[model samples]
Target: MDGAEREVATLLEQLQGLTSNAEQVEGFRRVQEIVQHRDPSGAERRVLRGALPLLGQIVQLRNAALVTSILQLVAQEASSASSTVTTASAETLDVAAALSAGLYEVCHTVLLLSHSTEKNVVLALQLALGSLHSTFEVALRAETVENGLDTEPRRAWDAATRCLEAAAGIVAIVPEATGSDSNRSAMVWLRAWKFVESGVMLLSTAQDSSVYRDPARSNIQPNTWSLDRLSAGTQAILPKTKLEEFGVMLLKAMCEAVTSKSDNRLPLQRRELSVAVNSLSLLASLRPQHMPNILPKLTALSTVVATPGTEDPVVQKSLTANLVKLLSHPSAQVFADEVTDILIAVGASQRAFSAISKSKEQRRKYTSAPTEASLRRARIGKRTATQSITERVENANAHAKRRRVNLSESSATPIPAEKHWQLKKVRSECVILGSGETQDSKHRAKNNQHWCQFLMK
Candidate 1:
């Protein structure tokens, strides 16, 4: 074997060692640095692919450090290939094809580990989320750029598409992984949302006609294309429908989290609401046909707006403004009638608020019980804090009597104090008659003596 081949072999050994035993972490880091910066020769790249099989085996060990190293290796490979593909088109680097071979299992393993009850596994998966997104971004970039180039990189595009589909499939398994842990489900869903968001943002930038690049580097110049222009220009390669699908997936995941809450209100935080609203707004702008489908969720956000717990009024107003802005657009004029109803239902304007309040008054008659129940619970809670002194004393006495009765119920007989006292009186009378006793004793001493002990019963 050549020197490059020997290096690849040694790196693969390190990766294997790292997986079997975590002590080899430094070895894995060396491999990462070589792939990322040293720019390994083609012979070494081919040999590095050999580690793909070992990824599945090591993931079973569920060691965060080792698993992360394995994923980092894959990420570095994809990053290296990405740099090459954009710069040196003359020499094709099919990293996607090589990585896609093992991408599905890696993603699946991470998905499983993400929901682990163990803190270490969950944290490791969180750390790995960035690597997963990087991998997906490369696939998306390849797919988007396939049409822009004169000769289509069909293999890379196909591999990239498969990876994306696999990622989507992994999202479907998130619920199963979380089981009954709502917090875990929310976390998994957030990660999935972010993954989908990266794709959607890329697609959006590509689709925008207004985007322009510094034209110093064209196809001949290759990788010199400015990021903004390259991203925008790549828009021509991806279908609008495919992009919308990703956006919809993100929205679906977010909606799942919101709906999973006991009260079914959108999260009150600015960041969470902003993301949901902005995403919906972008989707509406891109796919007007889906406006009808998106309106219900937008309107249903009223509960979030009306929620008393949130301190910020601007959050609600901001959501309202976005909806109004979208509906009022000239292109959206066709949706005017539907828009009017949704606006009124969401109480976005004075007329809308009036209509809603009137209808709410009518509905309040039937729905009064829920409000009443809440008020009743609140009253019961307060009564404990402000109980009257008489009531408190009565309760204390009742409790003491109940405790005494319970103690008596457990015994075979009650104390015979009354009978013993009567016998004591008779004995004292006999003693008084038989012997002249002092008529005077300390009144306190007489009173302190137990009449029952004097009876000698």
Candidate 2:
């Protein structure tokens, strides 16, 4: 037999053995050697290229640990200098393709496992989904930037689109399992939604940057392309229509899970529901202009939050934050009364105040205190002692007012600008009202004064 034929035979035998024995580490090592061997024209190299399909099959087995290892190797190779060579390029592309296929398989497997009676498998699937989402993102981004294209690389974008499509499908699969039986799956879906949200945000950010808008910029950063170009390529795969469908489905599933009163699913459902609410909140915040599209989804979620006897502290907090932000949307006033009622019912106002107060304290503690010696050093000029006193008093009053405002929610009490200078002087010496009340309060007070003086001077 020819050398190439012999090498192919040997590699195939190793793959079969590895799979039969489930020797994941050994199998991965063998794949690595095949891809990395220096001999360009050698039989082993040719055989290795042919073995891509087999590697894909192994990933399809739903072994997340193995999939993770393979993905890491692929990412590492893709990032290396060797990946740019002509011969190495084909191998890199093949590896990327294989990994993408395997990722889809893994996602599918997770969907199936989500239905398992075993808790471990469900939890494992949730964790696996998270890892797979991140890996897919890295691979997708790498492929796009691999070679500077005037437009996004269609192949890479298509692959990413498929991955997200698969994820959406997985989320849809467990709609009926909404109560406890599917709580874990719901959490996985929530995370997957975040992955999609971030991807869109990145795309949007890229579109807004000069790199995408001006072709005259000689060195266009990789992945920077006109939104028009992106929209065209992504139209079929992640069109607005598809996004709306997915968004609606996600909202429905989360609401069902969260509102489920079944004893078995209550805890898990509540946890997943909290995550879903947070994810929705983030999406709303990042894409406020898309409120018309998002409002209905929020409405559905709000219904669950508003349900009597379902006032979970965590969920309430999440819902309140989302609603407060939603108030900024033009259509928010339509639901303002209901949203406000829920916020108050859940004590979100008090919670928000407490959070603000704590944040002020934290800011105060971490900031450096202005020493009297530093103040004295600043009085180098023939400025009158009264002038210094006036400045110090202004700094102290300003600092005190800020501490009060930050600690209190009332927006009506605006401290005079001159008072800030007085507050600054006393900020280092005496504790401002509400200052040093808590660790967070002290830090916050100190930070406020530090920034105020820094800016004023």
Candidate 3:
């Protein structure tokens, strides 16, 4: 081996000895120095790339200090790469690809721990997930421009999808295991919502197909990639097949989770429902090739909710609301409006059926301001003097205050005025009787009461 290659190998070995946080930070400090060198060798570049997965190992052990170090390194490297105005080179491309791959591995490993019962472990995993998601995204954009249709970018996306799957699993399992009423369950469900939201956001990139297309054929031969295999290789049949499969599986699972009841419990929480619907809406917006089949599956689930004796009124109402949202969706226009009747049959209120129409009308009226006073009349009733919203709020507050005063008065103790007066009069008579000196004193006291004495005379 060459002297430079030997030196690079030795440096990497020293990096492995970085057992302490201080040592790791110092090691990365030197690595950064090497990166900033005017002409870094391929071996040095490899060392930098190799260090990324090592950080993943530290993260696996759930070491807070090491994890922080790794995150800072990622941020530093990413910021430096993005902010630089230099021309791209083959070595730079390699570093970017390696960084992307390592970050993906880290995210995938962390996500596998998402279902942990330990709060700390779960929290760390979530942090790792967020870091990996953002880091991988930036790397993908940078690398895709340099190395068009590269497998590394596709692999990065797959890692993100896998992370989402792990997150969703955590969401489903925690509530089921903990009886849905525990504090832990609530927190885990919250994490689950975050994961779902992230997953949807990640999937949103598909809206721009040019940015997220399958890898093109390489000179190596008839080249293609699968979800399981994102790199350019001699492939027999299809590309992105597995990715499509994963998307389908994810959508189906989410739909079922949102709609199906858990024995006696309600279907997923309301938040989960909203997140799931949002994810599905995004997926639908992407106009996936398999959406026709997916839409039918979604509609079938809603149909069962419409049938009698499946869920209680509250569950039915929630499911119906989601279904209505789906039907009124801009993406779902291709699907028939049959869901309205299904909703009504399932005991959806009349308001629920007319909700979409009303919303459309409201939007239309807002867009086109009416000049005619008659057209501007209130739909619900006659306008009451056209008060400003602020004025209305003030009036409402005053009314509420009056109601509060009335309520306080109604709950207050009686004043007992009559009893008080009678008590005072009795006390005065008692005092008169107690103070009397004798019959002569009594006659003098009676003479002092002039009106009564005159009447007696």
The C-alpha stretches of model 2 lying farther than 4 A from their native spots are 1-9, 17-24, 39-49, 61-68, 78-156, 172-191, 199-268, 329-334, 344-457
Cα-based TM-score, every candidate: 0.49, 0.49, 0.51
Candidate 3 is scored at a TM of 0.51
lDDT of 1 by residue, 137-193 (tens): 444455544434422334333434444443444344433333554424545444554
Candidate 3 lDDT over residue span 1-457, tens digit each = 4443345446556766657766766765565555445224543355455455556655554344445555555545544543331354544544554554565566556556533334543453465455544444344344435434456545555555666687667655535444433324656656655665444334322422212211111111110111322235532222345545555565556555655553344455545554555455444534344345445645555555445654445544654665565554444545635666666666765745565564344221111223456445653255455556656889999999998897687557453676556545544443253553787757655654543323222
The residue-by-residue lDDT of candidate 2 on 1-457, one tens digit each, is 4454456446655655554435756666665665666335542234433544455555445445565555555444433422332343434444444444444443344344433333333443443334433333333444444442312123434545555554555444443345664534455556555545444433332222122211111222323321233333444322445544544454443334334444233333565566656665554444343444555655555555556665456665666766665554433455555555656666766644443333233221112234667666766576899988999999999999998876575445565677666665656554575633778767776777676555444
Better of 1 and 2 by lDDT: 1
Misplaced by over 4 Å in model 1 are 1-22, 26-44, 87-91, 96-108, 114-189, 201-273, 286-290, 303-315, 334-457
Better of 1 and 3 by lDDT: 3
Q: Tally clashes: model 2.
A: 30
lDDT of 3 at 52: 59
